[model samples]
Target chain A: MIHFNDVTKIYNSNVKAIENMNFTVEEGELVIMLGPSGCGKTTLLRMVNQLESITKGDIMLNGKSVWHSNKIEMRRNIGYVIQSNGLFPNMNIEDNAMIVPNLLGWDRKKMRDRFNMLMELVGLNPDEYRKRYPHELSGGQQQRVGVARALAADPPVMLMDEPFGALDPIIRTHLQEEFLQIQKELKKTILFVSHDIDEAVKMADKIALLKGGKMMQYAEPARMLNKPANSFVAEFVGQDRVLKSMSLYTVRDLANALTLKPVIESPDSQNINENLSLRVAISKILNQEADQLIVENDNGTRKGSITLDLIEQFLHREIKESV
Target chain B: MCSGGDLIVNLIEYFVSNFTFILGYTWDHIKLVGLAIIIAIVIGVPLGIYCSVNKYAASTILQIASIMMTIPSLALFGIMIPVLSLINEGIGTLPAIIALVLYSQLPIIRNTYTAINNVDPDIRDAANGIGLTTFQRLIKVELPNAMPLIMAGIRTATVLNIGVGAIATLIGAGGLGGIIYQGILRTNNTMILAGAIAVAVLALIADLFLRLIENLFTPKGVKK
Candidate 1:
């Protein structure tokens, strides 16, 4: 677990970038540090990795203060991904992924194996991409390689700074989905910083919203949406908190045994994946005449189904709990 | 037809008779230009990198280089002559060598500094973000990225050095300049033409050689 105790960052004679910040990120949880452009969320994220030095207070990793370890070794063990996708132009994708490992003096065979595995993990084909340089790859592909490169060493903690901010909307959503799948499998402790609240809600296990460098609210997406800490948060989350909450949840979250079962009677022409957003399920249910929709998991196994009545009841229950 | 034919005959005869005489000076010219350029590079590249790294130092070093560049080549040689004379290095290759070295600093240093400083900040951020030490980043990333521009500088320096080396023969530093000066003193057009053509070819050869290196070393990803 990563713990920040009264962390504050001061610049040039006392401009407080972050003030008296306190937060704990549990191991294997993806925490999105969300705020406006100058909210110092990025500063807070960088401090965990010691990229930005803490002006005051201690940041402990696994209950040990980071100062006790060598800075280079500490950074090597913590993966970092940036929006610019810092692949070395001189090296091909394979070499780029192997940089940290190469520095740590991993054997040739081991680095090669990890490169192939990471390429597949981030949804890039190693055969086609390994020899291509960073400049040769498209923006989306380069970012995918960036993610793979960051995870090449299999670090327990990963820091991502607006990893998808440079991509187009379609590519961004696709990458986000792919990343969530990776996160689910890897379960690395990730501190992701983004100004986009929708991204935070979609991907974060917990969203830490900040205003003027102070924590406005730090809670699960559902709680943050339903019970905003203050007016600033309520407005930042917007009038469509309920609708936004729907995006945070998916078909699998609500389609329990009450509505989910093996496909029965007839197979509808359309099927929704169990992993698809609830918004899509709602659209599917409303668009078609069927009362229910088929749901499949990652393996394409016909796990369960979602019905119109179940979604309505789930929404009603959520509204009741929030009130 | 008569005038043109006579000119052709005169050139061919001049070349055949003076082939050995020209060959020795050509070798001397190559040595003069080659030595000066190599020494300049040895001093220049590191100085340039240092200037790029330090802000205050860059302005001072660049001002010195710009000042050197603005001086007339002949006058610069005159200044070097007296300075070298104090050590009994007066008149000949040493003073000329010193002059050539001074003349070369502007292109080599300026190119190296600009190339190194021009490396994208994003690359440096990423390198640091991924845990590369500052030294490793310089050696592995910055230098390779700056190679093309640095090579361009060296090539310019080599060509300029060769042209300047030709004038050094006036100070008794023997080269093709020996031929050019003799032709000037005796009004021998044929000798002057020969020296001029050889110097041009030498410059072209030097430029072509560095271009090959620049192309070979430049990262494919960075190429347009």
Candidate 2:
């Protein structure tokens, strides 16, 4: 739904922050602009909402040129979340979350209902938090409120600039999982910016890796990990690309790809959900020193057993097939 | 000089006899200070908001306010006499109000500018990103956040003006200063003490009143 057409950003008429960037973010797709700092990822994302001015080219949102669109109206329709959570310190939780809706002139009852629903969507208890200020909230709670606020108006597209970057690692992971679940239900077109590779891989439908204001590689996480566009892409994806790509598949995926070993029930063995990722399986095997793990469905039906040897074979088969 | 106890009783007697006189001057003092402060707020607050927006004007405006602050209140009153005389308002309440308002600007403008300018940049970014127009951002976001510091500025201005209002009697503006000046002319320490004490009491009361107002106006979310 969002398309960048030969976009360029040059600061002070000489410092090129973004150089002729061209990409399309498909509808309902979460496209992550991933890169190290100063790769122009943030500048690029801000260009979508016209927060940053375009030096040379234009960006179109749903075929309407963003530069030519009414800036205020266009932004009101697009949700924007930043790393700081940016909850207004002077407002209570409900007021902060319902900012856009209130601006759009939703009546008090409608705003109240929307605020409660959004808080629930972001895993906050609206009634308990409605009167509380941003300062009264924990970092994670504040960030949750930030997400709810962005989604308050139920905008068609969302621009999140490292929304979870400020939280501690544990909280960050929890929020990421919760956000992915939220995205599944809402399916809003999202342009997420992140410097962390694992975050991009875990949450992005497509990864647009950038370097020094240039697009390095733009592909699915699995494809980018397996077949990098260039040397920089491979290195940027990291030396452990195989292991990183392993996170993309679940125990169920492996079972479907090949025959699993018959279950050898043992008192010391741990049963893991079949839907869990291969990365988790690897960690369990190495940490518990179990030769194999019994995989089960949600109802505790034994699917089969998966061993380290079996996992290796599955990876090879998948790589070979993709190649 | 009488004994300390005798001095105390004598002063109480003087207060009891001239209670109505003291009350009238106190009312005049309140009116003079109150009118000047209200006028200063009306002019200084908008000018401060303007300075925060226009970077080029901020330096010039702030410098001018600082200079106004540096001028002695007595000198400011003296300058007001000649300048306001051309407008047919040379003496009395007009020149006194003019002097007090000029003295009030530095704190009000400085504090307002700093308060608005220093509103967390992140919040400002979020405000703009969420599609608030400039005017709405100021009213709903920046100004509400700025209320505490802006109120602090007004409190400072109010207290400062109350002390300086005592000087208005020098220019024939009737306030508690008139009582103090008359006492000085007659060499009566009791009258001087009463007027001086009244000005001090008025400053304390004004500050406390503003603190209450500051509490009322500050957003609950931002209260420490």
Tell me the alpha-carbon RMSD of every candidate: 3.1, 1.4
For A1-323, candidate 2 gives per-residue lDDT tens digits of 99999999999989999999999999999999998899999999999998899998889999999867999999999999999998999999999999999999999999999998998999989899999999999999999999999999999999999999999999999999999999999999999999899999999999999999999988999999988889999999999999999999999999998888998878757788999999989988988767779989999999889988999999888877766
Model 2, native contacts kept? 0.94
Please tell me the interface RMSD, in Å, for model 1.
Answer: 1.3
For model 1 the local lDDT of residue B113 reads 96
lDDT of 1: 0.86
Among the numbered candidates, top DockQ falls to 2
Candidate 1, residue B176: CA error in Å? 1.9
Candidate 2 Cα misplacement greater than 4 A, ranges = A265-269
Q: List runs of model 1 lying over 4 Å from the truth.
A: A257-276, A285-310, A319-323, B1-5
Report how far off residue A5 is in candidate 1 (Å).
1.8
DockQ of each: 0.66, 0.89
As a TM-score, model 1 comes out at 0.92
RMSD in angstroms between candidate 1 and the native structure over all alpha carbons: 3.1
